[model samples]
Target chain A: MLKIEGLRAGYGAAEVLRGVSLSAEPGEITVLMGRNGAGKTTLMKAIMGLVKTSGRIELDGTDLAALPPHQVPRQGVGYVPQGRRLFAELSVAENLEMGLGAGPAQGRAATREEMLELFPRLRERLHQRAGTLSGGEQQMLATARALCLKPKLLLLDEPTEGLQPSMIGAIRQVMVTMRDRGLAVLLVEQRIEAVLELADRVSVIEMGRNAEDFSRAALSGAEGRLRARLGV
Target chain B: MDFGPYLMLAMLEGAVLAAVLALMASGLSLVFGVMRVVNVAHGEFYMLGAVVAWAVTTLLGAGPVLNFVAALIVAPLVVGAMAAAADMVILKRLNYDPERTIVATIGLLYILQQLTLMTYGADARPVVAPFNERIALPWVEWGDKGLSFYFPWGLSTTSYKLFVIAAAVVLIAALKLFMAKTRAGLIMRATQGDREMATAFGVPVERVYALVFGGGAALAALAGVLIVPIQQAHYLMGGDALLLSFIVVIIGGLGSLSGTIVAAILIGLSDGIISVFFTPTLAKMIATLAVALVLVFRPQGLFGGTSR
Candidate 1:
């Protein structure tokens, strides 16, 4: 489980996340909703310690605010940053190997082997350069790299953004499998139907503040009004 | 001299010189390839290598072979460390601007050159060839034109220049293997190609960048050391070679091994051949002008990727 209290963070001279607070319990797909420039990414960056922040960010009751962005992976928070920023010059195999870092992970290379089963296409393209991959394949590689770490909390920044319908379904299945395995997922996304149907609980973020918290049932009849406000 | 024998001798010497030039040029080009830094200080590194080799050998009372061997180890590590430090303090702050970076490194090059001169006292030192024996071929006749080829048959190549030539070729091949096969090497490739994305993936890019700078410096230094036996290790030894290396790198395409090697061989042979007919200065000028013309037509050098 990941929790934040009054998390305020921003770039120099521009504050994005102003006093935002939220929590996602185990096995919960908590989708944080907002329009463009809604501090969604800022929140994600703050959580990963990529951006400097003031306020408490705790993962399973341990303070994570002081850690570096790279250290967050060790703290069980695997962030798939926006734009699927993969190591372009490296082959797919090298990218996965780098994710493992400083040798094999926890005496088990099994995590990677398992992922190859879930995403067989990656196994086929292991020797191919990562940058040459399609958008969806690159996204899968990025997500799979994080999943390779076996993190407790997965912070996904728009996994479905710019993805084809088939790719979306594949990613959705990946999320479903993660949730079924009791993972805490902090999904920052724009898609209404997919996120609403997939997320166990929803938290709407309007201009850096938590506007609404709802269950899947609360999405009924209010979809149009929410869609209009969000311009989704 | 008969044209046939004269031409054959020129070709052999040119090949040996080409090997050394290729080694020096690869160091310069590889640094640019990985870090995109001009590394104007590269020449300083080469001078330092020769100086270090001379001093270490003298102080240790070692033989020329040991002196050459000592230089092989010391130059890269010392210069590499200095390069790493420079990157951390100077380049780290400089916003990755090509123009600024070039000026900054040119400044660095002078500082290093002056530092060494102050430490070592501006003098040229000679490094002796390791062995005494010269195994000579009795005679090699090419169509009865009387072309005699001589070398130490037991050892690979008796001439230190020829030895460096062999090492240079091997080093390049090894580097290609490292870049293509290794995981960490792949990270460097990515960093060089798309710096922003490499950082996003949590690559220790800054550290890698410094390491590469130092690695290049070290290689240049090695070249200086290798050249010591052929020429003297002077305060300005790196000056001429550095200019030639830059031309070779430009002609080779920055950061490309294949491009650099082919171009170096071409330039080295051209220089030697031209030297037979003209002064060294004119040979250099012609080589530079030749490279300039190549750039005018193919800005990326002979083999550089067209897009760059």
Candidate 2:
């Protein structure tokens, strides 16, 4: 399980995530929903240790907040940042290899062959530069690159933001697979359809603090309340 | 002497010049490509190599070939370690801010140059070539013998000069393979492409920066060692080298490796050939004019992509 308790973080003086607490259990997809500037991304960055934070971030009894950012991924965490920040100039294969590199791998990373199988579109364009790939393809590549880490906890920030319906379906399927395999998926998303389809639990953050939480069963009963909180 | 023989001689000299210049400038380009920091102390690294070579040769007091061989092995390693240390102690402290690093490296440049002058003194010192046996180059003539090859007068080069050219080609090829086929090279390219993404992906960006800075200085040092036998080592020698290398790096495009090599060859050969026809100063003027034209028309450089 991945857990964050009263996490406060931001760039320099201004704190974006203030006293927010949440948890995503194993074999479950927990989506975080909030309006713009509500600190969803800040919470994700705090979990990844990309931003300065004060609070507890623990994964499977290991204190992640104590580790450096580069060491964070080694503790069974895979991150696909908000923009699908693939190494643009590098070829698709090279980018995948980077995920499977010696620095990131902790004996459980996926092999190149396994990743190519997972994203078949990447197989044909293995040698193509990541920058030239279509929007959907880049997202797929980004997701696959993260999966190469074979993390027990996957943190995806808006993976389907600019993707097409088919691509969204493809990524949604990957999340389901990961959840079924007993990985903890902490996703920051806005699309209610994707949230309805994949979320086992939903948490809402308002102005950097946890406003509400719901399980899949509880979410159906409280749709109106959740929509009102989300302002959508 | 026939113009043909003179041109051949100039070409041979140009090739030697191109070899050394390419090695030096490629290091500069590599540093900029990976760290995005301009190392003003790069030339001082070159000078340090020559000075170290002189020290090694003088200390060994052995056969010239053996001493030269040892100097080659020691100079780059010593200089590389020094440069890496400097990166950690100085550049890292500055956070590699572009403008601050330029000023910091300029300080480092003076410190290194003055330190060398204090120890090695102001006089230029020469290191004997390992083996400078002259080999007469043959020329073809359509005279009475009908395309017979003859050893033309004043058409010969030293064996050491040939070795310099061959060594450079081999080193560059090795560097290419290292970049294209190795895991370490992939990490370097990854770090170069996106530093933040690389850090997020578990790359030790700080260590990589130090390694690149060291590697780049090592290349400049190697070039210094190579040219020391032909051109004597002096504290001020790095000034001209720095200027020429900057010109080559700019003409080739900021961080393009292939372009650096191509521009080195273009500049080195023209320097030799043009100097043969006109004065050395005029040749330099023409080269400077070329740089001006390239900058005005193609600011991104000859091979630089529109966007870095």
Per candidate, the number of residue pairs that clash is: 1, 0
Candidate 2 lDDT (Cα, 0 to 1): 0.90
Model 2 spans with C-alpha error above 4 angstroms = A102-110, B143-148
**Residue B101 displacement in candidate 1 (angstroms):** 3.3
lDDT of 1 by residue, A120-222 (tens): 8899999998989999999899888778767788889998889999999998899889988999988987878876688788888888888777786877766
DockQ of 2: 0.70
DockQ of 1: 0.28
Local accuracy of candidate 1 as per-residue lDDT tens digits, B185-247: 777787787665454445666788887887788878777777787777888777888898999
- Full-model lDDT for every candidate: 0.79, 0.90
**Alpha carbon lDDT at A97, candidate 2:** 86
lDDT of 2 by residue, B1-308 (tens): 68898899998898998899999999999999889898889999999999999999999999999999999999999999999999999999998998999999999999999999898999999999999999999998787757878898899999999999999999888887897889888988899898877877788889999999999999999999999999989999999889889989999998889999999999999988888877788878887998999999998789877645
Q: Every model's DockQ, to 2 decimals?
A: 0.28, 0.70
Candidate 2 positional error at A30, Å: 1.4
Q: How would the docking of model 2 be graded?
A: medium
* Candidate 2 chain B: worst-modelled 10 consecutive residues by lDDT: B299-308
